[model samples]
Target: MSIYSPLPPEMIWEGWEDFKPVWQEIKVNGRILQVEMQGFNQARVVRLLSTDPADYLNSAYQPGCILSFSPQQSTTPGAINDNPPV
Candidate 1:
């Protein structure tokens, strides 16, 4: 990758290695969505994982959309549930 910017490398790549993103897979409306954790019960949609082309047309699942979901307890003891957004 070649960067032709007049700015020095220090200004362009400052804190580049220090940044880490938290990614999680969440299911919403029967579609699985890859999202980046924004905060408690909040996430930013990164991409949609679906076989149906119609699933990609939904604006709710578009990248960069914010989704809010609640965590639920699993029926199995000591298990976590995969709860979709309400």
Candidate 2:
């Protein structure tokens, strides 16, 4: 019986509450992407393995906003590929 003391008196206390992610990681254009938060809106893409394909850039990113990537290493879900460079 202590979930913030059942605040229900014209509630008014905004502080502490900045941590929610079913999956996050974004740095678009520079490399590093792994979004997966489809609850408050949308944020697909949970795969992207670049060995040197120009780092695979061109992902402005949309839906809400609040990225901070730092984890990359994927490739095995359909195996996207389109080789065409010497």
Model 2 pairs in collision = none
Specify the highest-TM-score model's number.
1
RMSD (CA, Å), candidate 2 to true, equals: 12.3
Q: Could you estimate the TM-score for every candidate?
A: 0.72, 0.24
The local distance difference test score of each candidate is: 0.87, 0.53
> Model 1, 56: alpha-carbon shift in Å?
1.4
CA RMSD, predictions in order: 5.5, 12.3
Report the number of the highest-lDDT candidate: 1
Per-residue lDDT over 26-47 for candidate 1, one digit per residue giving the tens place of the 0 to 100 score: 7787899999988888899999
Point out the worst 10-residue segment of candidate 2 by lDDT: 58-67
Error of 1 at 43 (Å): 1.1
Candidate 2: list runs displaced more than 4 Å: 1-18, 24-32, 39-41, 44-53, 60-86
- State in Å the error of residue 27, model 2: 16
